[model samples]
Target: MIDSAVALPQGRRQRNKARVQERLFEAAVELIARHGYDNTSIDEIAARADVARGTFFNYYPRKDDLISEWSARRGTELRRSLVTEAGGLEPGDTVSRFHRCLAALVELNEDRQEVNRSMVTAAVRAGCLGARESATAELFTAILTDGQARGEIGEGLDPDRLGLLLRDAYLGVLTRWAVGAEQDHASLYRELHEVFKVFLIGALPRTAHRDCCPHTA
Candidate 1:
């Protein structure tokens, strides 16, 4: 086995790389918010982060890659929250878990509306939000797969397609809220909640329990 001391430098290098990547994300997000995504360039991002262009590429192959990483990180955080809220993805608590995740995300975005809008614009232009191979899609697909296995959700549906649909709908609401007026944030949150409310109901198995239909009037 390799000596722990020998591996220490490698661990340090990994930590340094993560720090540099985080700085680049902060710089790029700020610039994109101020100058718009199309106008922001790699060189500018490097300059803002006070790093060389090559260093930026070492972390992210391209600007789109950076945006995808940011979106994926957010998705992972949401999944963590869902697991925590629902006690590890209990299929019967799917609707409640989704609500908790959305509420947390909305509360987060409400504090950084402009940055959220810029990020959404970049994500849309880069087509990262809908990427089938994205972490965001993978997480949702896993959720649906487990739900189906537990007979808590529709079994006939393709989990991958359903995952993409759910992701797209989420992006749509997020983008709308990011671009909408501050005064309308509450209303927009309601719209987002309603969208998922409908989705959860629709995704239920035909023989789902009455408790599964959380939106019953």
Candidate 2:
């Protein structure tokens, strides 16, 4: 059975709630950036946002929720960019498509360097700030699976392991860039692309010396 009774003020209250939530999220980001994750408190965020402490609780059960929300939003944006960029690439173009995706991700991070640095620092410290890590890994796995099915990526490469490797490498590079590294982003990406091309495509000469199980590249 469903209750169809309506409250006249329900709609208005919902709108108000949304507005308060937005304010709380904004306040939390600012406070976290200023005070670091361990020191930032819900009461501080509420006061900074000019909302009551109860309002803060209504939006985020805890301070970490704010970080999780932010990470999820950024992950969604990255996934969208990857999908849109890879839309029409041929199977043979998988390597190029992946390079473009990596470049796009670097550019996106460059645009949000400060927030990214802060988030990475917090996540590294707290270990699990981003709930979307698994989702991002899944996205990589799908991309690799498609490439492999089409004969673009090499056979016998475990999609899950490859995905995890790529995520670690990408995050490691971004982490370095975030910490005031002056390396040229494009050059670094090109080098990595070359490595990936040789490793995944087996384009290197048979006689070329190579260690087994090189995760990078």
Candidate 3:
């Protein structure tokens, strides 16, 4: 098994394994939704999934592994949204795409502060935040790389470096909101958009910058 999982399920055995994992993940999510992540026990999750407590470990070696899956599904959904929300497969300008990404992030957790707080807190406790942050950076890198290919971002800019910078700034906003820096969803949305604007000031191509800030030209 690769990283405690089959790389891909080609046979009935692997397919069955995948289905069991899906059940475990959904069960954990339901419990975490009702009870805080920390308060939810593996035994409870297993019972909710109709599996023995030991069976849960067969799929998820650790409880945090389930949490990681829970967290990653959201990220995968958000990335898919960047296209689906834009209508079909055509991508928009990188600037607008980036904006949409951050906007969706706020909307994703805005109404569920307690849930978001609980999950993020649990992720931190599980020491998985760094992995999550790395995933975000990887997404940003892909976005920047796409932009560069489309001639939207500067050719000289290092996509990896810029991506990490954007990730840091992007997560910084969420970090504050997650910790109650923003009192409500509306407040969090505003900060996310505002921070994205600030990031764009430097992130934009020189020519594009002039267009955005006409007076600067």
Candidate 4:
């Protein structure tokens, strides 16, 4: 979902540039998502975007730039879902809110063997994963802080520190998925729900109902 409204460009020329840039980036991700990243070259990305091969360089100096952009967008997706509330914010169960946030995350990661592997390789090589992790961790901290206020989350928990750990746990499962170790669960969503159980053990108040976990999310 579009997280926010974008300001219109002042000039027609600037708008055209923005459109071309978006088209190129969208084309690149679609191509990489379909074919393996390594197998998809600059030529293919440019052709798919309907731009000249040289024009691709005009927007992205190197192919890795596109990957870095994609990684940033992935991080933004988390914030968009949680902070902005794609539809509209409605107060509810903190646990359920967090579950939905995580479910959105799970939906973002592809299960396709070649595509995910290639995307992981590109993300790692681009060196943007750490930034993504940090941004996502901050969002986690925000959620935990809110949950604590609502008396749903455990007290005495360090939201900032725990947020970083949550980020680690999130990536840990993602790493497993990336490595094709998600075979235990029938599907990726199920796999994440399984892993999230461990987090709830520490996150929820001791008095919180064990049945509060939403497995269907």
Candidate 5:
């Protein structure tokens, strides 16, 4: 007879492991948001999650690892949304598509403003914001490269440089909004749309055929 004690099923073990990881992640986010990153401890996270300290170690080697993983997940989601929303538009339509996507993103964030602010605050305190910045740069690079190849974006602008500038611009705007520096998201978005319109007009290929004229609404 097989020793049941010695032979734990793989599937059950995997499910339990996944559940533990999820709990730990949730706990980390909550604790960090409440106490700030530096003050949060692994033991506190484990206690809050109702998991043993060993389980926390098994899931994340360190508290910072948890923060990094969480930040990466959030960054991935944002990148996916940006790519999905912007992918279908032609190169010349990049400006309008971007404006629409930005507006949608702003709306989404407003609904989850507190959580978003908490995550941003935790990430900045942990120094993981730089990783997020790099991820944003890469996402914008993909967008710019595709736009350029399709003759949608202007020729003189380097994709890498343009990507960096665009990432910084969007991040700056979001930061301001997240910090409550701007109370009127609609007006902020309108101003940004106009700014992007002027910027794109100078950056997009002059010879590119425009199916739609850029308009600031």
Candidate 6:
């Protein structure tokens, strides 16, 4: 799900740095997912990654940097799914495409609910959740901008603002799911869709057709 925009590092030093960063992210995520965020520390993460404590700090100045990297990957995966669901330049149903994209994201992360919960907690504590320039928000904003141009979304709303709001809403639901998943993942998924329905209503124009909205001139 990596975007082509991110090129692989050519030099040995750069490659090694990238590899170490990835290992740190993987180790941190695994630990945080299994144990709660507060329960996991820089020492634990460094040990899990088999790197020295100083090495970990060299790659990531703060523990939250690992979580932020993981979040960016998740956002990229979701964005890729959305692009694929759009059928690549074909006239597509934005609503259906969006649902499919969201479904893919939920399916991808459903098994790691505890990890998601921990990540959310850590992100909030580190103020990462408030970052408007996050990959997740950027991707949503791009999609919403297209939807607005195509008359699939409400004209009155600013695409960037609406996108941020939608992203926040989804993140909120994700936190809720991570914290309150006493039942099966399917039940929690249903709640996500229900919340999305409200978002759809808010985002779409009132005159939008039941099946798919008509394009504007």
Error (Å) of candidate 5 at residue 3 is 34
* TM-score for all models, in order of appearance: 0.75, 0.72, 0.73, 0.72, 0.67, 0.81
Alpha-carbon lDDT, every model: 0.74, 0.67, 0.73, 0.72, 0.65, 0.74
Model 4: ten consecutive residues of lowest lDDT = 1-10
- The model with the greater TM-score, 1 or 4, is 1
lDDT of 6 by residue, 1-217 (tens): 8543456546787778878988988898898888888898899999999999999999889766777677777776776666656434224566876677578768767756778777776777787667777766676677777888889887877878877887788777777766775767686578778776887875556676554635643
Better of 4 and 5 by TM-score: 4
- The 10-residue segment of model 6 with minimum total lDDT is 83-92
List candidate 3 stretches off by more than 4 Å.
1-16, 83-89, 111-113, 202-217
Candidate 5 lDDT tens digits, 1-217: 9744346655787768767888888887777656656677888989999988988888788666775786567655666656555444333356665765566556655654555665556556665434435665665666677778878887767888776776667656666665673477485576556656755765557676464355622
What is the lDDT, from 0 to 100, of the residue 193 in candidate 6?
A: 84
User: For residues 23-106, what per-residue lDDT tens digits would candidate 1 score against the true structure?
Assistant: 999898888878777788999999999999999998888777877776766766666655656446644455665667667677
* Residue 74 Cα positional deviation in candidate 5, in Å, after optimal superposition: 2.2
List the lowest-lDDT window of 10 residues for candidate 3. Answer: 1-10
List the candidates ranked by lDDT, beginning with the highest.
6, 1, 3, 4, 2, 5
- The list of candidate 1 runs beyond 4 A from truth reads 1-10, 84-92, 202-217
Cα displacement (Å) at residue 5, model 5 = 31
Span of ten consecutive residues with least summed lDDT in model 1 = 84-93
Clash pairs, candidate 1, are none
Off by over 4 Å in 6: 1-6, 84-91, 202-217
Write one digit per residue (lDDT tens) for candidate 3, span 25-88. 8788778877888789999989989999999888889777866776777676676767555433
Query: Residue 154: error of model 4 in Å?
Result: 3.6
Clashes of each: 0, 0, 0, 0, 4, 0
Per-residue lDDT over 2-26 for candidate 2, one digit per residue giving the tens place of the 0 to 100 score: 3222343457777687678788878
- Please estimate how well model 5 matches the true structure, expressed as its whole-model Cα lDDT: 0.65
What's the candidate order when arranged by decreasing TM-score?
6, 1, 3, 2, 4, 5
Which of candidates 3 and 5 is the stronger one according to lDDT? 3
RMSD of 4: 6.9
